[model samples]
Target: MPSITLIVNGASKSLEAWDPDMPLLYALRNDLGLHAAKFGCGLAQCGACTVLLDDMPVRSCSIRIADAAGRRVVTAEGLGSPEKPHAVQAAFIAEQAAQCGYCTNGMVMTAVALLRAVPRPSRDEAKQALAGNLCRCGSHERVLRAVQRAADSERA
Candidate 1:
């Protein structure tokens, strides 16, 4: 077993994994007990297990735990709390962007990264940024609106 140190949700955590190639999602959910990132498709196409790695959106299900060592990993739980939700999270709630809510984590995390990179992205840009994330409930419209709403709130 290898002990890997990771910065998760602004906190440092030491996790042990038998295989260095173990997916980051396992360490996050099993070891660290962060459930915000869900496992939809282990293949990384669904984006259900998305998280922010050094402020960039990444698929935790595909990233090896060793590769995430020493990196700043921010799961959806790290994004905000129920009381003081992140702007993107608030916008998602306000827009009712989630139907089943399985994909909300990925959508929110990816939107946070997108907003950080492009403060105010057009609808097309938002669509492009979220193209990788899939919502089985087909809440694309609301998700886009939530991203725009978050952008507006950030500006204000």
Candidate 2:
């Protein structure tokens, strides 16, 4: 087993890797108990396993545990705390953006990354950033509104 150190949600954690080929999604959920990032398509076709790698959103399912070493990994769990939630998370809650609840984590993480780059992303830009993420419950409209709300809240 290869030991790897990962900075997840601004916290450093060390885990023994059972397989070098283990996907980050498994490592995150099985090892570290960070299940906020879901498992949809193990092939990366779906955005259910999306997480932030050094502030950029990446699909954890496609990335190996070895590849995640020495990088900042942030899942939806890292977005905010119960006492202090990230603007995106807060916005999503206020706007009721989640329908099935499976895709909300990925959506929130994507929105967080997008806002970090563009505080006031246009509707198209918001949609574009979230293009990889899919909501089977069909909450695209609410997701867009949540992004907008997050942007507005950030400016406040």
lDDT top scorer: 1
Model 1 lDDT-worst window of ten: 9-18
Task: Kindly list the per-residue Cα lDDT of model 2 for residues 1-156, writing each as its tens digit.
Answer: 569998988989999987878899999999999889998988887788999998999999999988989999998888788788889998898999998899888899889999999999999999999998988899999999999999998898
The pairs that clash in candidate 2 are none
Off by over 4 Å in 2: none
lDDT of 1 by residue, 3-120 (tens): 9999999999998789999999999999888999999989999999999999989999999999999999999899889999999999999999999999999999999999999999
Q: What's model 2's TM-score?
A: 0.97
What lDDT is reached at residue 83 by model 1?
A: 100
Could you tell me the TM-score of candidate 1? 0.98
Q: Output the lDDT of residue 17, model 2.
A: 83
Off by over 4 Å in 1: none
